[model samples]
Target: MVEVRPLPSADSPLVEAVDLAKHFDVSPPWLTRVLERQPRTLLKAVDGVSFAVPRGRTFSLVGESGCGKSTVARLAVGLYTPTAGRLVFDGTDLAGLNSRAAMAPVRRRLQMIFQDPFASLNPRWRVRDIVAEPIRAHGLLSETRAIDRRVGELLELVRLTAADGQKYPHEFSGGQRQRISIARALASNPEFLVCDEPTSALDVSVQAQILNLMKDLQRELGLTYLFISHDLAVVYHISDYVGVMYLGRLVEWGEARSLFRKPQHPYTRMLLDAIPDLEMTGRRRIPVRGEVPSPMNPPSGCHFYPRCPFANERCRAEVPLSITLPHGGEVRCHAVEEGRLTEAAVRQALGRGASAP
Candidate 1:
């Protein structure tokens, strides 16, 4: 059996996602369904996912597209109503806020930095107005003059020219727009920020700058982040902890260093393989063989069994329970739990340079 440590109680986590889920009923209206001969369908975007972020830490979600990573980001920020689970922010259950009026306090304390800064920001609005919108919405600053001054301070904080806020979103580069997005998120002085692929669209060099800016801001403000991205390279760079999600469930999660060094799941191994190996002189990255399985008809037992090379009859029929490993974490793999697959095979598959998370 896996030995589970209560994260918040143990290391004092700043953000806890406890059995969080979001299911969507995608069925059409009954009358339309009858006319079109359609059946009611449900989409499980996020299913019983849980993880915690210690104070001043970066917890990232990395997975393929449509793997519920972005959905979790949305659910975390209350952009979508949860059909089954609840969100606990700082020990308070979010469901207790029954009314939008009651949710105001929580709203001001939480913010989101969205992907695609070009699309996220209003092209019509000047950058000053763009950053100041949050300040005005949350009543963070009383005077209009103070709001612009605050926006200027935020611009400087993000390492952007304060005068740049005078222009529109199109006036800046992809990276600069993203910085503006970060500044806007910081305007409300949120304790927690849900960053949804905040750098996926930018150039590799610019990505580093944005990442460094985020890290600096986190250190200065003591912010907690639910960082979302499909890129493992970026995740490895910025995250203190990493969570791997597939088809709506977290197959593996642990400290960033440990997970990269010793990924316990076959799927996790595949993800690691996707990143370019800088260590090997003439390295050839073995691309993940197959496309992601359809979420509407996910495979049974281990959802990754179809693509996993080590999978056997038992793996196809029975779900593996999480097993606590001596290396400082738990792994959800039948072969690992049953001791059917030895550590050597895992090491060979992952490669020689795999280090501890």
Candidate 2:
């Protein structure tokens, strides 16, 4: 029998990832490599990432397109096994669970919302079946009548009526299809959700609607979330804590308000600078320099040193360990660690006056 563990206290994180890493072998075939005298290539999609999602709260990972946020999402839900490190759900180490049967109990409480709603749902499956799949697969409801009733409840919970479930996925609009996806995810009564750019594919107006609905659901169900997105605006709205990723590693992470108000890492500041200055603070925004380096051949020391303005020889030669910040959270930057990147220096670099606050 699968051992069931008690849920952790509210004060403890519901999901924790410690030094999580996922590497993909993207090299040429063995035969081809032998003939061409080429070395094998490994893509470090997520390298040594760590974070925790508090129960009933959202922890968001934000970064550029290839920064491995989605890979982290998949790792959280067990879609891809981690190449190293541990993924702990509640109190159980997911990697320690050896078999599919052993993983079932834990899997039932975790679900994922994909980027594209149109592609996630089956074309021929009715919305009812799609939403009911998790319930049946988990054997949560055996009787037809009970399952149907539960499906109706799930649909209504996502703000869609039972009647809508009778139709196919193609019959609904993009937003409605995503709603169906949410309903399906919720059908298993999951305690945690890994949402991977769930709103990116929708129109801006519709994105707000979906985000609002997710927030409402969280409040109502006390669900935990590991949200992945490239949009800082969206992360700002939904996240209680935020981690900024670069080259598969978390560069900076802390409470959302603190991190956004006073970003310490150069990459984090660069990202915030890219946001339009709607309040017209007149702070000179630094245009991000250089392209992101390929993950297969990341720089030797700090992965971000190539584009970091404050990088010195030390930064280029040695990896910076994570340093605890005064307010809260941690940053992995040699400049920040060595006291070279002070608040005044950051403000000056951004062309902001001392009084600008």
Candidate 3:
């Protein structure tokens, strides 16, 4: 079982992303490049994104698919190296931890729960082996009996019976498999977890179970999470703070309640409008307009210019820098910056297609 420890005070950042960026070369083959006289092409998967997760709090990134949310998750866990910028974890720069021996202790405190539970666990491995692998790899215990005991404790902690450890991955349901994945993550007693859409693959009811389980674990163990997902409802339910991304850039970010209550950016407002209200309220649903442009040939100015309802010549000509909002979040949009996109104005505009609330 994962041991609980005193959490650091909330005054400092537990994980910091400073101008983080990741670029992948997607150029043509050398011979094709020469024949076509083509230069190198780079896909800016993540570009100049920055955020911080306070100790013991959940910080989430929500965006459309291919907006680099998964890339950010992988970068946070050191699975992918940044092409630029720095990722500072608990005051230590991950870039400086060059060797396995140097990163061993850090690795023990940082774990990742991948997106698909079916693919994350080894089908061939028994539950016991899967849960015990981290503990064994970290050399946390010596004897086989001791490791077995720990594995049993972890399984029980996640609400699984010790006897269940005898079963293989295929024997469990989707939720059960996710619980096993969580147990494995906690095996080394990690301080922070990078959950890459951990509950996305399950049924809605099962997703709630997993989410509740994660929240309970966080409260009980003082665990910090950097959650990544495209589901706005899930993000709303789980995140303390949220960052909205568009084409590799953070378009808006702030406290979850604030962003949801009064989204400042056009892209953010559009996303919130897409959330379905089950009460059959008169609130309008503004369908997300246009598809995300290719990263390799993204717009020169604001990435969302092509789809933004408020886009103008200025928006298409110059990129908007991150500007602080009156209430506490940051937004990157020319309309919001110049007071051109007020709450009332946007409501009136989108209300044309929406029913009266």
Tell me the TM-score of each prediction against the true structure.
0.90, 0.95, 0.96
Q: How far does residue 296 in candidate 3 sit from its true spot (Å)?
A: 2.1
Better of 2 and 3 by TM-score: 3
The 0-to-1 C-alpha lDDT of every candidate, in the order given, reads: 0.83, 0.92, 0.91
Q: What is the Cα-based TM-score of model 1?
A: 0.90
Residue by residue across 186-266, what tens digits does model 1's lDDT show? 888887899999999999999999999998998777788999998898898899889999888888888899999978788
The digit string of per-residue lDDT tens for model 2 on 66-137 reads: 899999999999999999999999899898888999999999999999999999999999999999999999
Note each model's CA RMSD in angstroms. Answer: 5.7, 2.6, 1.7
RMSD of 2: 2.6
Which candidate wins on lDDT? 2
Candidate with top TM-score is: 3
* Model 3 misplaced regions, further than 4 Å: 1-4, 351-357
Model 3 scores a C-alpha lDDT of 0.91
